[model samples]
Target: MFFKPYMRSLAVAASLAVLAGCSSTGGTQDGSMDGTGAAGGVGTGTAGSGQVSGTGMGGNGAGQMASTGIPDVRTIYFDYDSDTIRSEFESVVNAHASYLAGNPNARVILQGHTDERGTREYNLALGERRAGAVQRYLSLRGVSPSQVEVVSYGEERPAVRGSNEDSFAQNRRVVFAY
Candidate 1:
């Protein structure tokens, strides 16, 4: 239950070193936390030009048009302890569904997340349910089940780091990763 005075100082130094190591910027071509570029698509470009040129969809398929259209909104938030899609996000889901249906070659991963509140197992199941809800919605809209995958990170990854209502609301959601 207690540490020697020297041991306490050593632990503090180690913690500070780890924190310092974590503070460096990422190496992504685009300034996103994820290494996948701005559009999350396979693209080619010269360095420092601020332009990407290539075939296929770009970063998570955002701004890339399919037969139906492009889906700019790739994330939809959820309420506490619920897997139901909110009314406001219906259109967003619809757009993504249409895009997938229109482009058979396109594939997407639905990542489900939840706020930190429940037990680990409970949170993981809740995340899966949230993602499955979106997958079902897409299927009903004419998207093939084969083109979509679902993953549950639960409370492992938080969009905003905090223990507040705003942070919780932001964390509970499904993201369409192309």
Candidate 2:
């Protein structure tokens, strides 16, 4: 009951072809051969490093992971009784500018605070001025005006509750919240 040489050779060739096809087009995690996830293996939906199933490509792949959550908050300090942005805070402003530039849909609320010095009305004005100053700086740096909202908390929200210089210094600052 031996088959002919040609028939045996044909059977072997067919088996090899099937094996090659199976290996080349691997199944996804869901057991689908269309490069999608079958159950435990990599997802065929998208090629990414993370195990999470995404519809498209995963992380940025340029060594930077895509932000899956809210962006981190960045704070910048101002001089005592002044709303002017300090030179040291240029980097912080630039970072905010870059973020706003990259994410047009993103927005920030700039809260200005002042130390307990003058009357509440005066402090309010000072805080407002401070927030305006920061807003101008960010605008100059290319951040859209619509992306930033300025608010002056005045002496209402002090960073450090005290009458000392250290507390005042801490209170006199601008906070950026997203």
Candidate 3:
């Protein structure tokens, strides 16, 4: 807890180095964090440019890619301390369910996660329940149970790092890795 003058200087330098390394100029001259040439963060959302959108549904899908060429959306979010899927995200789940039902041989791994607000044991159990909820939803919609495998990481695997609500929102999620 005590720092000499030299140690303090070294600590400051290390902190600056870390901040400098992480400072993204929004990814490009156009201020596009999406790495696309466009200014918007949604990389795949260029009009008639055929870029894949951020969510697989909008940016790249059978329809989006076929018509505009965009791809990939793997994460689905959940409410705080709850495994219930929001009604707003039902379409996303439906899309995956439809895909699995249509392709009998296709399989997907559901990775469940939780924010860092609970005990380790509780988070693990919550993660499992979240994944189970997704699995159940998919099965009810016609995706075979055998085609889905669930894994829970609880608070161990967070997509975002921070103590604020914004970060916590990002951390509570279920990712469908095909």
- The candidate maximizing TM-score is 1
State the lDDT of candidate 2 residue by residue for 1-178, as single tens digits: 1111122222222222212222222211111212222344332222112222212222232212223333343666544433444434444565676677778899999998877765787677777767776787667667899999999888888876877544655776778888
TM-score of each: 0.62, 0.59, 0.61
TM-score of 1: 0.62
lDDT of 1: 0.59
Model 3: per-residue lDDT, tens digit, 94-126? 677777787888899999898786577767876
| Winner by lDDT | 1
lDDT of each: 0.59, 0.53, 0.56
Worst 10 residues of 2 by lDDT: 26-35
Local lDDT at 55 for model 3? 27
Q: So what's the TM-score on candidate 3?
A: 0.61
Candidate 2 achieves a global lDDT of 0.53
Clash counts for the predictions, in order: 5, 13, 6
Off by over 4 Å in 1: 1-70
